[model samples]
Target: MRMHKVNTAVTLGAVALLTAAMGTASAAPPAGRTPHPQPAHPVIVDCVWHPQVRPADFMIACGDGNSSLSSLRWSHWDQGSATASGVNVVNDCKPYCAAGRFHSYPVTVRLDHPQPWKKNPRVQHYTQMSLVYTDGRPDGFDRVVTYSLWN
Candidate 1:
């Protein structure tokens, strides 16, 4: 009788342990329902800037369903003179393919100096701009476009 009781107790303990483990597993959130704790990869499809306006504004529209924008940088060049800087502005957009969910971020870009043309007028100046999203990953969204500016 003593041996039988000991065996029964051991079996009951094992069953309880198994049951607890299963319950914990079942309580976990379902796939695609959990939030990503880190910034996801950024997908940049296109980036452009307009240099014709005073206090020029550069706009970048990009998306990374899994990541959030932390900062942005812009760079440009004209005739061999190159300039690069960061801007502080509002970055907001929806996920590339997902609807109803949108993310907004704040970024900063500081221009080294006003366009040389702005200070010493020039004719039809040409410039190229590129934007870089900091804290960007390579996965999550299909595409991301970021708009920025330097005033």
Candidate 2:
């Protein structure tokens, strides 16, 4: 009789727990409160393969760290495209790379051609990066230059 009572008690406890869990699972949000959806914002994949949004500084040349963008002021960032104005700093390998001088130029940066990132298929990353120099630019560099960002 004691064993039968224990079994019945265990079964009843399990059923009660399951019923409470099901009720909680199907319950709606609290009164006067609605769930907020998450934003599907686009990003820029950095050299180390990380998604970044409105980064202040970004390296252009991943190989030798010769070219980079700094002091970025992003005016717009969305799924279609992004625009920013920053300073492009380039290392002038004058005599040698080890002993190089860095130069900064006023530039407007535009990012487009977004696609799904390889590492994270659900995330979108900018594939194209274009820079238009507003003032003096680096030697041997054009007024407008475009590069392919790593995904």
Candidate 3:
């Protein structure tokens, strides 16, 4: 009985220690890795009609809150259509002011061919931008943020 009690104590102590470590890790960035700054209203550059073949990574600000899409790389693109994947990094502002941690979730974005905006026949814009998440969605974010994109 005494031997069983000693084993139980050791196991409980180890579990507690591990749980504490995990909490700390989540509360802050992991050691040796600096946190990347998230910008307010990140620009989706050249969002006009037939944009200048931007296969490079770009940021998209949803404008609803602090979370934004970061680091999009197009894996495929042809004839004004493109498919890419990126990350949605969010500021989890918990506890109080300035005590926030950023978390990244995998997401996929699609840009459809441009069409003339209803308001202006001369100006054109991508009719839609589809954002589908692969993992770790922030609270209140839909699995897909497919919305109309206009100039």
If scored against the real structure, what TM-score would every candidate get? Answer: 0.24, 0.74, 0.50
Rank order (by lDDT, best first): 2, 3, 1
lDDT of 1: 0.39
RMSD of each: 19.6, 7.2, 19.2
Cα-lDDT of candidate 2: 0.91
Which sequence of candidate numbers ranks them by TM-score, best first? Answer: 2, 3, 1
- Candidate 3 or 2, higher lDDT: 2
lDDT of model 1 at position 139:
35
lDDT values for all models: 0.39, 0.91, 0.64
Better of 1 and 2 by TM-score: 2
Q: Give the per-residue Cα lDDT of candidate 2 at 146.
A: 95
Residue 122, candidate 3: Cα error in Å is 7.0
lDDT of 3 at 23: 91
Location of the lowest summed lDDT over 10 successive residues in candidate 1: 38-47
Query: What lDDT score is found at residue 148 in candidate 2?
Result: 89
